[model samples]
Target: MLYYAPDNASLCVRLALLALEIPFETALVDRSCNAQNGPAYTALNPNGLIPTLITPDGPIYETGAILLWAADQKPSHVFPAVGNPARAAGLAWLFWLSNTLHPTLRMTFYPTKYIDAGSAPLLLTATRANLLGHFAHLEAHADWLDDTQVSISHCYLAPMLRWSALYGTDQSWFDLGKFPRLLAFAKRFEVTHVADQARLAEGLGGTIFSAPTPPCPPEGSAT
Candidate 1:
């Protein structure tokens, strides 16, 4: 198998691959350099996104899809094979992170494209508020999104939280203190062999290195 990843989105998939102990060659696509937009990369994924995986079957994009496919390929602890409640729960959180949290963070950090220049500030403010609200919601539950002991959701969320700090989104937004379980969970995941290598490869500067807010709480909670 071959993987095309950038410095950002590909980290999770790369970690997943490493966690599964699968050996694959990496094609590093530099997004800042506009390599992903070139004709060659665009032919692989029309959307021109990072972390595209070329398996014997074909190419796959999107972090969630790549992780799930990797899980299915290995069918071990990272993802259980059949009739595992934890697997279903893990899948739920994975999808939630991909569909919900990831999009919100993307908008909050890069809102210039969606709104007029005059109203961009307002849009960003609202987006940040919405993200905080979500963080508060996640803070209320202490089970790490899914009720699993360990799963793909943690891998997906780790990078998001890392980037949140980079965007200076305010640590209090997610109430990190209240979600001790999640914090410990993240710390434990960080020390894993694969996580260490992935962090170095992705240039994360070694784990957020400080406590940040937990995942946002569910909506409509006291903040």
Candidate 2:
């Protein structure tokens, strides 16, 4: 399998592949690198995004799609192909992350794309409020998202929370004290061997966001 990803959005999938101990080649692409928009990359994904997977079948985009495919290929641990209700619950968080939370955070951090950056202070404020509200929501229902054993939801959420820290969003927004279970879940996920692989792939020596800001925080967080 060939994986094409930028440093940020691709980290979770990279970690998942590592967790499965699947050997695959990695291709790094980005705007600074100008690789994602190149014809060579575009040929793989017309959407011109990173985290495109080229398998024996073909190329696949979208993080959730790539993740489900990876899980299906492994099928036992990464996913439960037996149609277990737990599997459905895990998949629900994957879709929620992809469709809801991710898009909201994207807009919060990329308001300049839709509005003038100079006059978009209210947009940023609104974005921050919405993001905090969503984080609070996640904190409230942390238990349902976890199992006696870890599931795919753990893999999907870590990267999103990491992105939140990268944007200078207060970790308090996650209500770590109130969401002790989620905090424990995150801690366990971080120390895994797969997370190590992702860090190495992303050229980080330790955790995904050990510093105040992550290398990538959407497009406008730093502006």
Candidate 3:
């Protein structure tokens, strides 16, 4: 498999595959250089998104979808098997993370994308409040939602928390300390080889998180 990852969105899938002991090569797409919009990368993921996995059959895009596919490749604690109640729960969390939580963070980080310049602050405030509500919901149900052994959501959530802390909003507003379980889950990956390598490769200067409010190019969105 050839993993086409950009700055940092690909870390989730890479970590999942590493946990499964899967060996795959990487084709780094330089989002900073607008590589994702280039003819080659766009041909792979028409959406011009980061982290497109090239499998023998075809390509897979989207962080959540790629993480799910990677976990399904082998039987492990990272994901529950099909038809199982736990599997159903996993799917729900993955979808929530992608559709609901991720979008909120995107808005918080890049509020300018959703509204006019003069009203960006108002949008950021409302969006950050809404995002905190989502975080509170996850925190309230952290026990069943987070896996001590590490799971697909962990890969997706950790970076989100990191983004929450670093984005247009400050950490004081969304204190990670309030979500101990989720914070711990994300922190576990911080010290791992997979996390460090992805961070360094992306020039992230830290853990596996891209620019929360990176400059706009001819394109928009880090996902």
Candidate 4:
């Protein structure tokens, strides 16, 4: 079972599972009532994160961990295996997506969690700049970013682009066109069967990555 909320990090894991065509179930972690903080959900993921994938072995928390575990289940083009020459590069970018890029986005999305609300604007300014740098770096150096193959990095990155556009206090700063390569990638990936499945599941409307709109989920709120 995948504990998820619409438009949350869990969406990334969902995309990976769909791409691999794996059979699984999902339980909505109703954010509207702070359900993630409840005892039952916390028992599975102490962090109370949106996504916690329950497996035969045990429960796996963390979006990146769940994605990697799912990819490793069988041979697939989405993820490179341990011995593949591309695995090192792929793993490096995957961790970079998890550790570096994702946290930076969190800082922007929930500024009050990191600092005082009155000073959030200043923090957003600096953080938005940092985000621009991150995107530019990926555009120039991330050879692993491929629109055709749709690697695990694609699952991770396309959502970051979506959230960056839709989440922050000031979404105007993020312009997909500035990074043409990533823009192209989003345009391509959004139309794929994998992305489309996630779109319908989460009520994420058309152009979810390249031109995202606020989510309108069927069962629970995106917040």
Candidate 5:
């Protein structure tokens, strides 16, 4: 399998591949040059999104789908088991993160794409409020994020916390004290060699902190 992912959201699935301990090739989709918007990438994912996994069978798009597929490739110990109650719960959060939390994040980070320049602040403000609530909800389950037996959701979430710290207006929203368990887990994940491999493969520097801002706004570009 070939993992074609960019930075930011790419870490979600990239980390999964690492955690699954699979042998796969990583391809960099240079979103900074609008490479993801080009025809070559679009042919892989008609949606023109980053993070499309080209499997031997076919291309898999969507963040949750790719991560779930990664989880499937490994033993049940890495991901939730089929038909287990945990499977349902994991799917719920995965869907929520992709469908709800991620969209709100995009709006907060790059409001200009979602609203007119003059009105961007309003959307940003509202989106910030929404994101805070989402964080609070996650904080409610901070312990679960670092379970000894990690779930795919845990892999999916680490990147969210990292990005929240980097680009958010109020970094305290992800400050260690308030969101220790989840934030700490994410920070640890970022430093690991596996994380570095994924980041560097995408042309992001060795540490995620050293990664440059994407050339253009990625907000409202995908769900």
Candidate 6:
């Protein structure tokens, strides 16, 4: 089972699972009532995070770790094989996404978690500038970005782009169109079979990545 909350980081793992054709069950972690902090859910994930993928060996937490584990389970094109030369580059960008990009977005979305409310605007300004630089770096040099194939990196990144557009307090700073390559990517990715399934399951509206809106999910809330 994959424990998830609608529109949460779990959405990344969901996309990977669907693309890989992995059969798994989902148990919603109702964020509205703080269900993730409850005993039952915390038993599976000590961090009390949204996604906790139960496997026969054990349970897996962390979005990137879950995506890696899922890809390793079967032969899939999503991630390069261990011996492949591309594996090194792939692993680098994957960790960069997990370590650098994802946390930057987190800080942007929840600035108060890092500093006082009075200083959040300052933090957002800095992070938004940082985000523009990050996207520019990827837009120019991340050769791993494939317009035709959905990789594990794409699974991690596309939702982040959506959140960047939709979640922050003052979202006016972001403009997906500025990154033309990424803009085209969002246009293509949102139409894929895997993305379509996620949209329906989470009640995510059209152009989820390219032009996201406040989600109207059927189950748990996005927060």
- Per-model TM-score, in order, reads 0.82, 0.82, 0.81, 0.97, 0.81, 0.96
Q: Which pairs clash in model 2?
A: none
Q: Output the worst ten-in-a-row residue range by lDDT, candidate 1.
A: 214-223
- Give the per-residue lDDT digits (tens) of candidate 2, residues 1-223: 5444434566667777777777888665656656778998889888876678887789988878888888888777776675676676666667887888877877755678668968677776777778777767777765654554445556667777666665533344434444565566666766777776666556544555322234442321112
Where's the lowest-lDDT run of ten residues in candidate 2? 214-223
> Could you list the CA RMSD of all candidates, in the order they appear?
7.4, 4.1, 4.5, 1.0, 4.6, 1.1
Models sorted by lDDT, best on top: 6, 4, 3, 5, 1, 2
On residues 1-223, what C-alpha lDDT tens digit does candidate 3 reach at each position?
5444433567667667766677888776765578888998889999886778887659998889888887878755588878667787778888999999998888876677789889988888888789878988987875654445768787788767766766565556777667676666666667677666655544445433322333232222244
Candidate 4 lDDT score at position 55? 96
lDDT of 4 by residue, 82-173 (tens): 88987888788899999999999999989999999999999999998998999999999987666487777899899999999999778889
What's the lDDT for candidate 4? 0.90
On the 0 to 100 scale, the lDDT of residue 121 in model 1 is 73
The parts of candidate 5 lying over 4 Å away from their true place are 1-6, 168-176, 187-193, 196-223
Candidate 6: global Cα-lDDT?
0.90
**Cα RMSD for candidate 1?**
7.4
Best by TM-score: 4
Instruction: For residues 179-223, write the lDDT of model 6, one tens digit per residue.
Output: 988988888899999999999999999999999988999888999
Runs of candidate 4 exceeding 4 Å displacement: none
Candidate 6 residue runs with Cα over 4 Å from true position: none
Error of 5 at 199 (Å): 5.4
Q: Whose lDDT is higher: candidate 2's or candidate 4's?
A: 4
